[model samples]
Structures are given as C-alpha cells and as structure tokens.
Target chain A: MQKQWLWAALAWAFAQSAAATPTGDVNAQLAEMQARITQLQAAYEARIAALEEKLAAATAPAAASAAAVPAATLPAPSRGGGAGAFNPEVSLILQGAYQHKKKVAERQLSGFWTPGDAHADSHAHGGDRRGFNLDHTELVLAANIDSTFRGQATLALLDDQVELEEAWFQTLGLGQGLGLKAGRFFSGIGYLNEQHPHQWDFYDQPLMYKALFGAHSYTQDGVQLKWVAPTDVFVELGVEAGRGQNFPATEQDHNGAGSRALFARIGDDWGVAHSWRVGVSHLRTTARDRERHMESELIGEHAVAAFSGKSRIWLADFVYKWAPNGNPKDRNFKFQAEYFRRQEDGRLAAADEQGLALGESGYATRQSGYYLQGVYQFTPHWRAGLRYDRLQSGRQDLGSNPAALQTVDYRPRRATAMVDYSFSEYSRLRLQLARDRSMQGLTDHQVTLQYIMSLGSHGAHKF
Target chain B: MRRFWLVCLMLVLSAPVLAGVKVLATVPEWGALAREIGGARVDVFIATHALQDPHRIEARPALIARARAARLLIATGADLEVGWLPILLRESGNPHIQPGQPGYLEAARYVVLRDVPQQVDRAMGDVHPDGDPHFHLDPRNIPPVARALAARLMQVDPDGSATYQANLDAFLLRWQAALRRWEAEGARLAGLPVLQVHRAFGYLFHWLGMQSRGELEPKPGIEPTSGHLARIVERQRAAPARLIVRAAYQSDAAARWVAERAGIPLVVLPYTVGGSPDAGDLFGLFDATLARLQGALR
Candidate 1:
C-alpha cells in the first residue's frame, strides 16, 4: 500500500506542473497581444500628428494670404489700445426736411397758455418753419473715461445755432444694482423723453409733447440714481434732482432744488414673441419769473406776464411689442402710448412795457394730453406708422380778469401717418403726412419728406 | 438675543451654499457651453433665446438686471452683439465685465475667423468688418475657445480651478471622440455643392469641405432682388447644387423661393441649442445637425 500511495502523489504532482506550464504559455500570448496593440497605437498617433501638421501647414498659407489682402476701407475692430485709441466713438447725424404746408401763419393755441406757445424765438418751437430746412445736425462723442466711468456728450446744431444737448458721466461698478449719472441729461419722465430726435419714428414731435415740453423734450442738469430689483420680472426705480432751466420752469439761480422727479417701471415677457412695459412718473418744479406773451383781447396789444409758483405733472406710459418667435428680422409691431396731466398754481403780473407790475393775481390751470401710436414693420426694410394726439384744457381762471380770460374751443387734435424705408439701421428715408388742427379754427395739411443719415460709430438705443 | 444670534448664524452658514459665480452669455449656445465648463461652480444666464437673431436685441431691463449681477460675461464679440451689447454694458454699471477686464471673454478672439471683407461700405449691407462672427459651427474651433474660457473661469473663480479643469478634460475627451465619429461619417460629404441663405455657414462649409454654389441673399442683410434671383436661377440650371441650407432663425421665404425654382430640397439646420426640438443640448445639437445634413445627401 505504501508503494501505491507514493506513485499516486508523484502522478498528482506531475499533473499540477503540467497545468502551470499552459498558464505560463497563455500569459506569454497575452503579453504579445498587448505589445501589438501598443505598437498599433503609436503608429496611429504618429499618423494623426502628421495629418495635423499637414493641416497646420495648409491653413497657415491660407491665413497668410488672407492677412496680406489689404482691408483699408474696413473699420478696424474697436479694441482697448491703439492709435486714436483714446478718441471717443464719434457719430454725426444729419437730418434734412422739405416741408409744404397750405398756409404759413403764426402758430397759436387759443385756450390755455401752453408751455411751448407761439414764441418769436426760432429755437423755442419746431415745425413752425416752412420750405426746405436743414432741420438739425447732431454730433455725439462717447468714451470710457477710465475703468470706473463713461462719458458722453452731444451737441445739436439747429438753424445754425449750436446747443449743448446732453453731457453726462455715469458710474461703473457701484454694486447692489445702483447706478449714478450726473450732468445734463434728458429727464426719464416718459417713453420718448430720453430718445434723441434722430431716433424719433416720425418727422415731428407728438402734438402733446410739443404742447408740454416745447418742441424739444425737457432736458436738465441733474444727478440721477437708478436701481434695478433682482427678480424674475423686471422692476426699476429712478429719481432725479435737477437745476430747472427748461420749458415748464424758467431759468433760476442755483439755490434750493429747482426740479425733482420719481419714476417706477415694471416689464415682463408674455411669451417668446411678446413683451410689454408699464411705468408711472411724477415731476415737481418751482417756476420763478416764468414769462409768456399773449395778444390780450382787453387791450388788443401784445402783453407780457411773468409768473412764479409751483407746477406738478403726472405721467403714465405703456409699451407693447410683438415679434414672431422673438425674431424681428422679418416682421414686428410696436405700440406705445403716454398720458400726462399737469396742474399749475401761480400768480401772473402783467407789465405794460415799463418795469412796473400793473396787477398781480393768483390763477390755477389744469390740462391733460395723450398720444398713441403704432408702428408695423411689414418687411425687413419697410415700416408704416400712425399716430393720434389729443389735448384737453380743463378749467382755467384768469383771476377775475374777464377780458383776459379768452374762451375759445379748448380741444386740439392731430393725426399723422408715415411710411419709412430703412436702408440700414443707421439710415432712413421717411415720408409723413399730417392733418393738424392744433390751432383753434385753422386746419393745416402738412407734408414732409425727410432723410436721416448717421456716420461713424453710434451706440444702440434701449428698449 | 440668543435666538436672533442663532438665526444670523444660520443665515451666514447658508450664504456660501447659495453663492456661486454668475455668468452671462449672449446666446444660448454659449450658455450651454458655460454650464458644461462651469459645472456646479456657476449660475448661467442667457441673454437671447435660440430663436432670436444675434445681430439685434432689445436692451430690456431684465437683461440689464442680469448684467448688473453677473461676475463674468461671454460674448461672440466680433461685433456680433454690437447692436445692443455696448449699451447694455454701459447700463449695467458693472465694471468687471467691461472690455479689457479679466471677466470679459470674447470667444471669437481664439478662433480663426473667415470671410473678412476687403472693403466695408454700407453699400454691402451691414457687413462685419472683423469677418463673419459665426465661428462656432466648426467643432474643431471649440477646443481653443474652451481652453481660453477655462483660463478665464479660473481667473474669475480660483477656488474652483480643479473642478473646472477636470470637467474640461472630460469634456475634451468626449468631444474629440465625437469629432472623430463625425469626420468618419461626414467623409462622403466632401466636395458637395450647396446653397446657403447667408454667410452664417462659412465655417461649417469650410469644415465639411463643401463648395458654396451661391447665396440666397444678394448681400448679408439685403433682400435678393428679382434680377439677382433670375441670375441665380440661370446659373443653377447649368450647375445644380445638392440642397439649400438655412439657420433656424433666418427667414425661409427666399430659401424656399429659390429651392422651389431650382428643384432642390431646403434644410433648416438648428444653429444653436434649443433651436429645434431635437437639439436639446450641445451633444444633441451636433447630432441633429449631422443627421439632418446626412439625410439631405443626394
């Protein structure tokens, strides 16, 4: 039995050794396969590198040839530093108009003395001149002052007279959604108040704007603070304190606050194609030595008055826009309207050529006006617009001066229709026709053909 | 007093959890890429929708609000957003995202731009002097832009560097693999003649080695005059193209007008993420684009 056990153990050992030898052979085969894969990978990488080199070589020549081609007429990209680097983006807008009206007469609104009533000064009123006119030329210069401030200045040339339109410096990086703007700026009271004349959709200002703000919108030297809330819906609040030297208020010495305004706006998108915004604004100012000349029926002569007191104006505005699928390239529509009510309480002192005040009496006046317009872009380059304006003068008491209180029809309205073709965003040709009944009894048919062209870099307008 | 202190402590503790770098992108495609590269480290906001044209945008107050809070701003920036971006930057009052700042990243600076005009006159209908700003159509251009964006991201948020680098490395691997697959599949598309609506697809055509037969628009923004259309139709009769291509945001009337007359199919490619139902994200965007092109093969 001992001899048999020894033989079996030897056989088992032989079997185990034989199995281990095959395992070693399998390991050798696996190593060979792994080495083959590594070699193939190296070869593949080498081929890729060669192809990449070839691609680089091919593209280098093409890029060189392209760069060698001169692009003298092309405006260089606006970068931080280069020759003329500190020079601001300068843009000049030229506006010319040819006007043909049925009657060329003194323009007057009879009922309530409008802020921009017929003034003898040519600069005080717009649209009064007839025939070919170089309406206005606007020159704008804007640049970053440093990393912390941006400055913009605009000069408007009207009838060969240069007027400082706007000059402002705005702060940058004042966190917490706060922004500060100082210097002369257009007051943000209504939708169109801040827009320059070159950006207006029509050739003439709305009748209501003409009545309240004079042909030019209210601009003042002021400091403004604005805040935007962090929310899903857009909400903004702004306040301004200014030196009142514009239409509603006469020029005054810098003493206390002359004008102050507060405004709030909220906006949101309805869908992919529609957006709307609504805002309410309130403005208050003290008018000191406000002057106006009227043909007094009592004396049948030109009489002058200087009034001093307070004026408060409230404005509400809404805007709606629709573009198919949020793309305005083909078709879009914009509708906007603003309503304003003014309350004036003051005393008027009439002077008869002499420096002596004939009489001083207290008077109160209430007036309101609104304008609604819609512009439709039927195609990429063509647009048509229509606007309706109406004004209502409420009760006006001339302080017991029966002859001075001339009661003519107090309602004035106007309708305007325009069609414009934009060659590009910077150039447009507009033809406008209007029936103006702004004067009491006269109906004027007015036609204007205007062209606006812009040169150089101009910043984009806001929504 | 103890209760008030406890509440304040809780608030302070939770502030860091909610605090992340805010990034604002002008278009949805850039927003998607930002989300990918800035994973878990950023809050991304897109200024314009996929269906909106990049050439023009309203400076809406909501966009201004977003710009005010953003720590980083990424734009295509060969003047692609010139119509509104400058005003938005001025209004935002955020100096960090202004030009020449570390927080501003213009993707066009990293890629080789195409179709730079020799002369820039308005007579050419609003041509970009810096060349075509649509360079992201080529997948190969994404890497350099991605690297630059990664560097900017690090500069903006150094605490998240490792996370951003790891994410970028992974993304590069996947993007490279996908690029290879696309190249293999697109090999048959080389030298194909095609018609385009605008110069928007110059990079794509250059990548696929396709030849541009003609354009639907006479110039970039100008409509095709009848005379131009007649000439194009006459030319197509002699040398026909395989198909007509347009981006989702472009007007289809002109493309359809020419395609019908020339007897070629019209294909509207999803130019960016969210442009089509099938293009849900970056991967899906390229997949849908390739599939559409392949399906249009003659």
Candidate 2:
C-alpha cells in the first residue's frame, strides 16, 4: 500500500509540473496522469473521512449534540443575497489646477446679467484662489438597483463642503425606447450643460454658460421622460418637470413644479468614419428672487440686484465627430457648437450693502450667446483644442429702473486654446491659455495647468 | 394608385414573416459567427468593424439605435465589451436583450478560457479577471461557442429552431474539416518563437504549439515605450525569436522598431473577420493568419 501511495504521489507531482509548464505534445500524458491522480486522491480522501467519522463517534457521544445545538441556533447561510455580495461600482475623480492670470478689477460678464457667483468661475476650486487650487473632487457610485432600475449618485467634495451633485435612478429595460429618470440630475438642456467639468475639452465653462447659468450649471430635482425612436437614424425626445430652485430661478413655495423643459435630438452617421448630432431644447421657469452681482459707479461698492419673474431659454446645439474607420484610438476630430438665447421679463430690485433700496424697475431683456469649439486628438495620448465664445446683449428694457438693472454696450467674448495629454484612459493633464474680454473694459490673459485622475470603475462617456 | 396601395399592403403583411430575428454583435468575429449559425433567418448587425480595437468602442447613438431594434444581442463577453456594452444595453431600452435574459448570449461562457488571472490588478495593464477574451483565434474553441449561439438563437426565435440546428451542424462540419487542414498546415510552425505586440493572439499561439518570446509592450494595453523595445531587442539578441507579429488594427510602428533592431521579419495578422482584404470571413481569418505565419517562418 505504501509503495502504491508513493507512486500516486510521484504521478501527482509530475502532473503538476506538466500543468505549470506549457508543453504542447505532453498534454495527453499529463491528462492520463491527472486522471490516475484524481482517482487515487478521491479514494484516499474517502477512506480518511470514514475513519474520522468513526473516531469522532467513539470519542464522545455528547459532541454530536453540542455541535447540533450551535448549528440549529446559527443564522441561516446567506443565499448569496446581501450587502457583502453586492458591490456597487464606485469611481472617484480628482482634479486640481494652477492658474496664472492678468489682473482684472472685477470678473463679470459684460453684456449679460451676471449672477452673484459670477466672479468665481465654476472651474475655480475655491472662489478663484489664484495660484494653486484644488478643484471639485467627485465620488460617483452606480449600480443596477434591481432588474428594472439602475441608480447613480455623484458627490462633489469641495474645499469646504460636500455637495450631492447628482442622485437619480433610471429605468433600465423600459421597452419601446422609453426611459424614465427621477431625482436630482443635470438638466439636459444643452450638450455641455449635461457634461461635467472633468469631461470638458477646455478648463473653464464658455462665456455663455458662465453668464447665463451662473457658477453651477442648471441642475434640477425633477422627473424626466425620454423616448428614442426605433429607426436607423438616431432620434430622441425628452421632457422634464422640476422644482426651479437653482440659479436662473430661485426657490418657490408652491407645491406645483416651478420649471418645465422640452428637448429633441436627431443624429445620424454621415459615413463609416463620421457621425453628427443636432439638438434643440427649451427651458422655462419662474424666478421668485434671482439675485445678480453688479458693481458700477451708480450703485457704489457692493450692490445686489434681484430679479423676479418669468425666465425662458432656448438652445440649439450641433456636434460633428470624425474618426478614421470609426476607430478613435489613433486620431479623431470633434467639432461642437451651441447657440443660447434667453429672455427674462421681471421686476428688478437693487439694494446696497447697508440694505438700503437703490431702485426698482421692470426689467425686460433679450440676450443671446454662442460658442464654437474643436478638439483634435492628434495621437493616442495627446489632444489639442480651440474654442471661441461670444455673447450679445440684444435689448434691455429697464422700464423704471434703468440705472439699477444695467446692460453694457460691450460684447462678452473669449478665445481659448488648450493641449491635454492622457497618460492612460484614467489620468489626464492639460495646459490651457485664454484671452478673455468678458469683463466690460478689461481683457485678462489667463494660463491654467490642470490634472484629472480617475480611480475605480470606468465610466462610459456619452457622445 | 390602387395597384401601388395593394402592393404596399401586401409588402407590409409579408414583412413580419420574412424578417428574421434581429441580432446585434459587438465584434466582427461574433458577427460572422452569428451569421454562420443564424444564416438568413437572422439579420446580424455588427456594432464594430475589424479595424477597431474590440476593447475600446464608443457607445454611439447609431449602435444604441441598432441595439434598440435587436431581438438578440451577442457579445464576446469576459469583459471584452465591458467598456461600452453596459451603457449601450442601458440606453437601448430593449428589455428582451438585457443581461440574464434569454436573448443575451455571452460566447466566452461556453468555452474554456485561457490565462485566467489568479489575481486582478489594473497595474497589470487592463488584465481581464475572467481570462483573455481572444479565444476565437483557436478554431477548436468555435464549436462550443457556435453550439451556445445556436441554442440562444433557437430560444430567441423558436420558429427558426430547425434552421438554426441545421446551420450549426453544417458550420461544425465545415469548421472541423478546416481545422484539420489548418492543423496540418500549422505543423511546420511548431516550436517557432514569435514576439507578439499584445496578448491578442495568446490562444492562437497555444493552439499551433508556437512559443512566445515576449510582448513588445511593457504590459498589455500599454503602448510600447523606447525602453521597453530596447529591452525586448536585448532579450531577443540573447534568445532570438523568429518573427514579430502584430494585429492589423495595431500600429506597426513599435513592432517595426523592435523587428528592425532585433533583425526579424514583422508579420501583421488579420486578427478577425474583415481585418484584411483576404480575411473577409471567419475561415479566411485563420487561413490568412496561418499563411502569414508560415510565410514569415519560412
């Protein structure tokens, strides 16, 4: 028996070595030995188990009862359904930047109504903390909640506060090309508005977005219904109803929704290598007391202007992407442009730092802005981009409060050029230079170096 | 006008019966396989062509639209389409083809995978936890995948069960005979050492009894750096490889650099169907690959 066992052991070792090394013809030999080893090992294990059971019975009759008592009281084994088994996909995005800018008196959009937060560009980490800055660090978690729904949440960690940027659940398999989403999410009014800052081609938002949507672009706590047409050409339509509680609109008291939006998109492949999309969207909301920041000789040092009434915005966006043979790894070019026009008819109230009312007026204005940008990935790792932003103040009719709700003659415009390098798909570094004339009479030349890194789950980007 | 209306009505009436199961395949190889099994009973739409890297694909609206209409979705799986497939499935809004459903078929699940990692780490350069997803290169792996696909097709389109079974049997016969021919032709390539640009052809090397010297890249998915190439060249000088091989989709620059420095011929294999002019289908893909390897070795 000992000799046979030794032979079996030797065979097992040989088979293991054979398995470890890649030997083409020896596969058959290894398999035969593996079979013999399995038989010997199973037979020996069965014998050992039988012997152990007999020994246990002989040693102590009370041992079985004791084991049974604990077994009965123990919690039932998990059916592979628990928090430990279900791991949600988690991703953390870290962004930081260094800025060098030419000094300007006050950072404000010249031709449009600037929000109180306008001086602090959304890209700036903490209120334009000039030199080195830590941008928004985002923690994102996403998972299929069940068979019917999938949920995602994004938490933005700022220097001083942690904000829930997006928390929403979307229907997964809603048939007939229909999907429903509810909770707080970015409003899909424009292409760039839906994309987060880290996904932007440039380091900063366009002058149009900055002047119109304030520091944080439009986000709504609402419900959205979208339908994609079952056709060869891509066609999508969506509508949203939300509580108008952010910038463009202030918090409202009524239970009814304060904001509504309608959007439609259509796109198609031009060829094997090119694709394009065009979309139009409209958002309408009521502003209770939307505050704007202004500093003019008329209102003195610190002036607060509040506008309350109807706010309506219309946006048209177009995107064209080209990749040779539809493979973007080597090289690709993307051209994107959006035109935004806003009309606000409201009552404007101006108050100084001392809470003294300067003036009140019926404000009516037609303002429009557009941005054109092109990003080219010259190689697998390097990309260069150029963008131009222009905003026009069509007509501002401040009935009784002309001095309070002011509109400048200058047009807000900015030109930016940037080059970014991706070390891998998860990490990127960018250097950007821009000439900004958004501030009435001031032209600021800005240089920014930024880095973005992603950890954990890989997020899919929507085109 | 009356005749035109009558013809339109007749065409519309016949559409459902004539139209087969709509199948969306994520890659050209799977697309070709779906065609072989599904035949005319299925209309296969390939989401990506052979020229594109299967690992990276944009979830384009065009793909989503196609997915929306597809009754069945086929993927290589084993995380090959992990980057974009989930997003496409979510956006497609097609309930029938969602995961764990009858209409969803992951080909890798049916085949025995190679190079399954003991531990997964991204630092290993995009290593798949399940295994290398390039198993289609080994022709022996095709039968099981084909069988699973036939089963899936039958399940999704019960009316075409007879056709799917017959097509699968016919495909297996052709595939078995072709495998024998490939094995005979590949006999001369046994024990030949080759440098691979990536692990894309790991199964092919194992199938043909060829030996791998090393990879051009420092790690999988990572591009070859000058230092890495120099190291590969230095190692090749010590233990020489016969040839340098790269997939047609991969750029030849790095492989060429290593080949020139190490004094070996560089061969670009058609990694999948339609990857090269000669490799128009599954059979052609293997035939072209074997021909190129044999030519380079000779």
RMSD for each of the candidates: 10.9, 12.4
Tens-place lDDT digits, model 1, residues A1-463: 3325544765575556556677567666556656765665456545543443343333412221111111111111343346776789999999888888866566755565656344533444245778887876889999889877889999888755888889999887676667899999998888888888888888887877766777457787989898877665778899999998776887888777789999999987887788888999988988887877755665566667667888899999999988998788789999999999989898877765455555667768888889999999999899999999899877766686533624454788889999999888888999999998888778888999999999988788888
Q: After superposition, how far is residue A147 of candidate 2 from its true place, in Å?
A: 0.7
Calculate DockQ per candidate and list them: 0.26, 0.21
- In terms of DockQ, which candidate is strongest? 1
Taken over the whole model, the C-alpha lDDT of each candidate is 0.79, 0.82
For candidate 2, report its TM-score.
0.86
Regions of candidate 2 where Cα sits further than 4 Å from its true position: A1-85, A104-106, A117-127, A293-303, A351-360, A402-405, B1-10
Q: Which segments of model 1 are wrong by more than 4 Å?
A: A1-81, A115-121, A124-126, A295-298, A354-356, A402-409, B1-16
The CAPRI quality class of candidate 1 comes to acceptable
**Which docking class does model 2 fall in?**
incorrect
Report model 1's chain A TM-score: 0.80
